[model samples]
Target: MKLYTEEWMKILEHIENNDRDYKLFSINYDSNYWFHAKVKGDEVEISNAKFHENSCSIPNPRKISIKEFSLAFPLYKQYTSGVPGIRYKMQKRKIYNSSYIIALIHEIIDDYYFRFSNILNK
Candidate 1:
């Protein structure tokens, strides 16, 4: 159930392989820090931005490995929960159902833990 584990990487890879477009955005309190991810077909891109409220800034996207994607989950959770004024959006409504990306991640994690427990029981 831990984040950023090998099994988590596998789940991310499986998601990336699926033919769909996904986007996730998380912003911290005051909007000083944020992370965004976009997945299309088999490619995934991630971007992080930090700036003062009065400043103009742009998020530079970069290709990221599945492992890096998995590692970012904890940081995203921390910022989204611990920081106030958090704003999050997952998946574009036009391209996919609202919150579908978040649900997909939970489903993958649940499936992974279930299989892992089965293995341990054997």
Candidate 2:
């Protein structure tokens, strides 16, 4: 079984207006930058996407999975309290289950960071 829980999978699968055939996730490095990640079988595809009200389109995604990639999360980043309000609003609108999916995303991010840190010997 995948590391993801059924509830997390439900949140991903519930994206009815995705406009694409796959599950898309947004990773915000901080307020200034973000990127899209979508499931592609065993590996994830990262890309720049143009987001719409309920959908997004990725014209050019990473076609090849990279053997090595590392980006340091900014050490001084601070979470703003306003973000939770925005997310809650989205959740209320049925945009997504931000609470569950955000936790899943955090778990995935934490796992990748540790793996990459070890690989990069940082």
Top lDDT prediction, candidate number: 1
Worst 10 residues of 1 by lDDT: 90-99
Model 1 RMSD, rounded to 1 decimal? 12.2
RMSD of model 2 against the true structure = 14.1
Compared with the true structure, model 2 gives a TM-score of 0.26
**TM per model?**
0.33, 0.26
Q: After superposition, how far is residue 114 of candidate 1 from its true place, in Å?
A: 15
* Candidate 1 deviant stretches above 4 angstroms: 1-3, 27-61, 82-122
What overall lDDT, based on C-alpha atoms, would model 1 receive against the true structure? Answer: 0.40
lDDT of 2 by residue, 15-122 (tens): 322433323334343322234555555334545533434334445664212111111121101111233455445434453323223432443444554446646864
lDDT for residue 106 in candidate 1, whole number 0-100: 39
Per-residue lDDT over 28-108 for candidate 1, one digit per residue giving the tens place of the 0 to 100 score: 223222333456444455444222233222345555444444444433443334455322322211222212233335345
* TM-score attained by model 1: 0.33
